[model samples]
Target: MKTPNHFKLTALAAIFSCFVLTACNGANSSTASSTADVILTIPVEAVLTRHGEISSSYRTTATLEARGEAEVISKATGIVQHILVEEGDAVSAGQLLAQLDNERQQYSLNKEKAELNRLASELTRTKEMHERKLISSDVFEKLQWQFDAMQASVNLAELALKETEVRAPISGVISRRYAKLGQLVNQYATQSLFHIVSNQQLEAVVHLPEQQLAQARIGQNALLEFAGMLPVNAELVRISPVVDAASGTVRAVLRVANEQQLLKPGMFAQVQLQFDVKADALLLPKRALMTTDNSPTVFVVNAENKVSRKPVSLGYQSDNTVEILSGLALGDKVVIAGQSALKDDALVNVVSVKQFE
Candidate 1:
């Protein structure tokens, strides 16, 4: 139906006005929805900051070793008569450990003593003759030399006889027993009789990179974690003065106390040498921090129940916790979980608050 031109223009204007009005209303509704969503709070788990001890540690692995060890060699040459101690036996210093064939030594010592007694009696007679001027000075001097030689032979025989009884050179656990009863042993250094080690104190032997040489120090506190065992306390006892050219690592040692005798030599352990510590520091769990950026960041929940993105400076960091040098304080709450969806000044609901022990 063809209508008048003015009427058609009026109808088109009316349609355009209606479309613009509907578009404006829809935009206003979308703005209101966005505002409502902005007010919505996110649920998260948080940890409260506290003043405690925090430390920076250098972590490395090492093998357990005995602080005092020795391989004892036989000192007597004869057939082994008896082995008093066996492997896994504890021994005290100077305690008899083994007995070689001492019968022959005893016989020789007795013969030498008899000869010494005979010489003593002859020397007395010779001295008496010399004093009476019946014997020449040369004869008296010969008798004196003979008597001295006999005395020295007897003394040597007694010493050799005593050596047949092998005594423990040090107090330690018998880790190895190479000597056997009725087996021929020699005084030569090549024949090892026993291996003794003082297991009461252990050592963690580790190699440190040259860069850490400056940080390694004697008497420094350390923590050791061994497999199948609880964590043990240790102290830095030694640091090598030279570097190994082949590995380019310096040798470092930590002493571990073993009053319970749990630590054994050759066991591998994880060592964390505490190089620096901050006492009475504001600390938080490392999970509370977002470290995947140029600067370390955290989401701190304020008293208003809003989350604020914070960039913080750190002091010392251990494996689990880190010291907050700035941008956080004691009693401040930090988001430890459900922080991926958080934003600055975002409303939040803390479902749980954990304390750092």
Candidate 2:
């Protein structure tokens, strides 16, 4: 028998309702899956916290200087007759550097020597005459006085002649040559014939903050950096007992050996005065620190790749690294890059990881 028309219409409506519900559920599932896949995950670079060495240090700039320097000057007045050494010549102490005109000096010396010889012969004759009772005692005494006076004059003449040769007062390399051949030089002139500097060792004076005076001590290690050169090692050789009132700093002297003569005077350098060091310290890269707040803060990544903002207490800080006193542990990954875009408990995708040795 055929079904009624109203029952057929009701069955069709029920089927239509079921189809609409199924389509809505399918759309909702697709959208939910897409949303989950698009969840924001920031890409960042991170480094694992590790135990390493950190040092408390003070940094300042200084100009290098030769520890030993000398200005060779003319001891006698004459014209420059010879130039034995030039700029950049290596010389030793007492080495002849130049020669001045000694014609006048030589003539004076010769005259004094001749007079000394004459006086010596006359004195010998007078002594023999006195011994033979032919000459009076007064004559012998007078002759002896003349001979002594002539001998003193001869000594002075010899010294004057010797001074004509300019000698290096110290062993060093000649940095400047002021006198040229045939140039007249005066003994009392303010000009220097040559400037010699010993580069076997170098020194630099740094003024550190007064607060660091106590920490600075003799025999402490220091590092010096110059532009376009590798760092050189130095030592704290001296410290000023008093602090400078005007600058509120203390003067400290650092000495470095330049056996190869690689370092020169007047070179500007960056100086690091290391006071204390911690051998095994929880170290973190300084780049990871975020100072937006009052205290230092860093974002640490957990095992699930989620970042959490942490406030860390600090200890000694060296170059590019800081000692993490608290709020961190060894092997904890800390976000170094892309931290600006991060918040607490944010999802992160560590693009790269760096390990500190």
Give each model a TM-score.
0.84, 0.88
Residue pairs in candidate 1 whose N, alpha carbon or C atoms collide under 3 angstroms? none
Best by lDDT: 2
What is candidate 2's local distance difference test score? 0.92
lDDT of candidate 2 over 95-192, digit per residue (tens): 99999999999999999999999999988888888999998999899889999999999999999999999999999999999999889998887569
lDDT of each: 0.89, 0.92
TM-score leader: 2
Kindly give the stretch of ten consecutive residues in candidate 1 with the minimal lDDT sum: 181-190
**Model 1: CA > 4 A from native:** 1-40, 291-293
**Model 1 TM-score relative to the real fold:** 0.84
TM-score, structure 2 vs. true: 0.88
